[model samples]
Target: MAKTVIVYFSGYGHTRRIAELAAQAAAADLVEISAEGEVSEAGWSQLDAAQAIIFGTPTYMASPPWQFKKFADATSKKWFTRAWQDKVFGGFTNSASLNGDKQVTLISLQTLASQHGGIWVSLGLAPANTKAATRADVNNLGGSVGALVQSPADASSDEIPPGDLETVKLYAARVADVAKRLHG
Candidate 1:
C-alpha cells in the first residue's frame, strides 16, 4: 500500500476530528501543524516519505487560518525542489456555516498541491441534494473539489454533521486508491 499522510491545522479540534476520520478511512499518518504553525522535524520527514499528502484546515473568515498558510509557506523548499511532484494530493475544509465560503479554502489547498506538481483528487461523490436528503446523508454539501464540512458555530467538535464526516472518509479512500494505483 502507498503511504499517505494527512497534514492539518485545527483551531478548535473540528478540523482535527475530520482529519482523524480521513486518516482512519485511508489508513494514513497524521501530522498536525501546531497552533504556532510549526511542524516538527519528524513530521517533515513523514511528509517527505509519503506517497500521498492530504491537506486539512478550518475555514476562518473565508480562508484558512494564518497557521496553515504559514505551513504552506514553509514548504517552499520542497516546492522548489519538486519533492512532492507526481504525488497524489487531496484536501478538506470545514466552516461554521453551510456556505461559509469553504470552496475558497479548498481551492487554496488545490492550488498548493498544483504548486508542488502533485496530482489533485476530486471528491468523486455525487451530491445528496434531493429534497428529501437530510444532514445524515453523504455528500450533503454538494462539494466536488474536495471534502466540505459545516459545523454550526454553536456545535461542539463532536456535533458535526454525520454526512460531512462520511464525505471526508469516502474522499480519503478515493485519494488512497489513486495513490496506491500510481505509487504503491
Candidate 2:
C-alpha cells in the first residue's frame, strides 16, 4: 500500500474535521501539528515513508496558520536533503469568509511543496460555474489546484457542505492513486 500522511493545524475544529475526512478517504495516517509543537517520532517516520502528503490549515490573515508554518520551518533539514522530492502533495483549507483569500493560503502551500521538489496535484474536477450548479454540485468553482473548502463562520460541524467534502475526498483519492502509480 502507498503510505500517506496528513499534517494539519486547525484552530476552530473545522479544518480538523476536513482533514479527518480526507485522511479517511485516502486511507492514510494522520499527524496534527499542534500549537505546542508536538509530533510523534513515529509519525515523522511515517511521513518519510509516505508517497503522498496532504496538508490542512485554516486561513490566518490570508495565509496558513503559524503552527503549520512552524511545522514546515522545522522540516528544513528534510527540505535540504530533498526528502520529499517527487512525492505527491495536496491540501485543503477552510475559512470563515466566503472570499477569505483562501487562494493565498493554497499558493503558500504550493510554494512550500515546490521548494521540497514535490509533485503537486489539483482537484481535477470541473468548477461549478454554470447557472445550473446547485448546492449538491460535486465540485464547486474557484479552486484551480487541490481542494478549497469553504465553511461559514456560524456553520456547525454538521453543516459542512457536501460539495466541499466530496471535493476533498476526490482530491485525496486522486493524490493516493497518483502516489501509488509513481511509487508502486
Candidate 3:
C-alpha cells in the first residue's frame, strides 16, 4: 500500500492541531519538522517512502516560516535526484487573521512540489461561503490551492476553529483518496 505522511513545522500549537487532525483523518503518519534543531533522519526516510506528502505550516509575514523554508532548502539533494518525483503533494496553512495572505504560503508549497517534480493536489470540496453557511460548515474560507485555516493568535490548539479543522479533515481525505486511486 502507498504510504501517506504529514510533514509539518508548527511554531505555534495551532498548526500542529491541524496537522494532527489531518493525519487522523487520512490515517497517515506524522512527521514534525523541527526548528530548534535537526529533523530526525527517520522523518526524512518516511517522507522519501511516502506516496503522498501533506505540508503544513503557519503563515508568518505572508509566507511560510523560516524554519519550514530551512527544511525545504535541505531537500536540495532530493530535488536534484528527483526523489520526490511523481509523488502527490498538498499543503495547509493557518494564520491569526481571516485573510492572512495564506494563499502565498500555499503557492510557495506548490512551487516546492513542482520543483521536486511532484503532483500538487488542492482541496476539492465546495466552499461553504454562502450566507446561510455556519461555523460548522466545510471549506468556509473557499481555499482552492490548499487548505486555509484561521487560528486566533491567542487561541490554544484545542481552541482551533471547528470549521477550519473540518476543512483540513476534508482536504486530508481528498489527498489520501487521490493518492490511493493513483497508486492502486
**Each candidate's lDDT (Cα)?**
0.96, 0.85, 0.90
List model 2 lDDT by residue over 1-184, tens digit each: 7788898888888888888999999998899887765566877888888999998899978999778888889878789999889989988888877668989998888888889999998888888978888656777745877788888889976678898888888888899988988888
What would the TM-score be for candidate 2 when compared with the true structure? Answer: 0.95
Candidate 3 regions exceeding 4 Å error are none
Error of 1 at 154 (Å): 1.1
Model 1: lDDT to the true structure:
0.96
Pairs with backbone N, CA or C atoms under 3 Å apart (clashes), candidate 1: none
Regarding TM-score, does 1 or 2 come out ahead?
A: 1
**Which candidate has the top score in TM-score?**
1
Model 2 lDDT, residue 158, Cα: 67
TM per model?
0.99, 0.95, 0.97
Winning model by lDDT:
1
Tell me the deviation in Å of residue 71 in model 3: 0.4
What's the lDDT for residue 147 in model 2?
Answer: 84
* Runs in model 1 lying further than 4 Å from the true structure: none
lDDT (Cα, tens digit) per residue for candidate 3, span 1-184? 6689999999978888899999999989999988752468999999999999999999999999988998899888899899999999999999999889999999999999999999999888888978898766888888999999998888888887788999999899889888888886
Q: Show model 2 residue runs off by greater than 4 Å.
A: none
